[model samples]
Target: MIRRPDSLKTFLQAGALAGLCALALLQAPKQAIAGPSGVAGTALFQQFPLLYQGVLVEGMGGAFTAVADDSNAPFYNPAGLDNIQSSSFQILNISADISYPSLYPTLYNGVSGAGNNNQNYINAFSSVAGQSLYARVGDYSNYTTHDFAIGLLSNNQMLGVANASPTTTNLGSLAALSDSGVVISGAYGFFNHHLQVGGTLMGLYQMFENIPSLSKTQASALSSTLSDNLSYGFGLVGNLGAIYHFDLPLNPTLGASILNVGTANFGNAGSLPQLINAGVGIDPDIGFGRLLADIDYVDVTNYLYYTGDSLWLHTRFGVQYQFPEILTVSAGLYEGYPTFGVGIDLWAVEVNASYYTEEASPVPGLNPDHIVSLQVAFGWM
Candidate 1:
């Protein structure tokens, strides 16, 4: 059983926090209008951070802009598909299980004590608690030749929370987020494979859902809301990427990508922002293993949202060591937060795990949120 705050002051503080959340939502940037949020304005946009490709990239703190050599290249930098030597198919699942230690207690307190006077508190807690689960799944298939490569990809992300304890609370909410799409990408290599250029044509889909109002009565009769509150939108987008490999020491690589170039209007939800990514990577053989290091910069154009700071430039750094096909370890910093990941490869299947932190709110004083991801990938070479 979770302990509840006893003093009125603590209760007031919780309410104030909820109020701030609502105010923040009202003042949120244009891009956040269609995103998920709590009744009191706690934005759930951070629940779906910039999408990364696979467990390998997440393990490296999302520093794959220049190191995109595998099936994930279409998502990270399509130009990297030029490096693929064989036909391949791969699928990945990435999930972020976020837990708010302080927020959950307040929520439990608000819902456990149900009275007419506390109805507003109960609604607020339910709204905030309903965004606890964030997950994504994707698949990539590529066919490569000496000078050309083509691939098909699909990816989806979902954010929602559920409490289905029949004996306790039956409240639940779901926010099916934007940015799931199917992409057809192709890459062409030139100058003896020293340079590669690629492009992706994406078919986009956006979705959203919610329970209008949550109360003890509604919680008990929530089965209907769960089945009916779904909304969707469709659009298209384009991406272009390029990579140049230099035969210098350690085989250094330089890459750049312009993502989401076209408009994806989710009706009233606004347009998806365009992003530019650039990075450099080095792969050096060190006898026992291969050491890989990368430095990347992600710049968002036409959006000022999340990350209390006004800087549009996000920095990422990652390093990984691979002991042939058996084991790999990675670590890095993603927007100033520490991230660690490990991978085990056994010929046909690979397993990966990562730990990282993300900002739950862009407000200056709030604590950061954490995520744990486990992935299993199947590959056919």
Candidate 2:
């Protein structure tokens, strides 16, 4: 078992300093963030632009606030790191993801035939209007022992969608985002370890590109230098979280967190919105396996600027069953859409996969983006 440091005072001081510095680094703009530049017609509301999302968490419908016992704790609720009994290190964690792959072939053929004709381009884009196409690649590695943890993470995401309005000058829209960062976290327990509080400092280098109106002429002259339009910046952010363990049946826990404390301004790349999230969870050993259930309310501050969004869009529910060192299965609801995930562990190597749907419109179910994600990792536990 990992041993606590000689003095809790030192740890607490370090944690507090990290949090304050992150928040002091940026000033939140008074005006609300503007919508994607130049896009015509309705666009999706963006909420909680997290730096990283793990497959296991996504599979569990993203309701991990109260059940953050793994490496992901630093991102969800660092206080959960207090539950770590043994030191763990992940040497490598690699992932790849795709959204709506079923529609790829049709889109590829349509784009290939459009050529330089404006009407053909419109027709091709209209066929897939309101549909989302996306792909991503990412990696994360971390080490944790008891009340302290550190990690590195990076991701690249590309997304495209046709203009929702046919009368607009745009044929389609495209966006690309990249984030690379380091995370330093610390936690402390109180009241005989029943209550834990923690904080994290995240330093990030971010780049973004948003072409909300890709006209026919632009599409015809697309070249490798298209990334010249990207805007890049660097920033630091902070998170504070706490978890209270209740002496009740099923080992109930309550968790809450304030993320992106003062919001982070990434220059022309845009800003990260502040969010308040909370959750309740229970973990019970049921003879044959362990059962976990969690319910969460995310983005409690309602950073979403769009109308038509319901409470269901911010509600998340999930359940997972684990069989010792062998396999794990999970299911849940995210943004009112069903999600499923599976994982296999074999001492030194682990593999996980998940299927989930994300909403791309102000209304749930109106524009669904189905995603398939997989991860492989090598680690010591």
lDDT of each: 0.58, 0.74
State the number of backbone clashes in model 1: 4
lDDT of 1: 0.58
State every prediction's TM-score relative to the real structure: 0.69, 0.86
For the record, the alpha-carbon RMSD of candidate 2 to the native fold, in angstroms, is 5.5
Write the residue-wise lDDT of candidate 2 on 95-119 in tens digits. 8778866556776787788776777
Worst 10 residues of 2 by lDDT: 36-45
Tell me model 2's lDDT, rounded to 2 decimals: 0.74
Q: List the candidate 1 regions with Cα displacement exceeding 4 Å.
A: 1-52, 91-174, 178-181, 210-229, 266-270, 300-304, 308-313, 363-365, 379-381
Off by over 4 Å in 2: 1-48, 166-168, 306-309
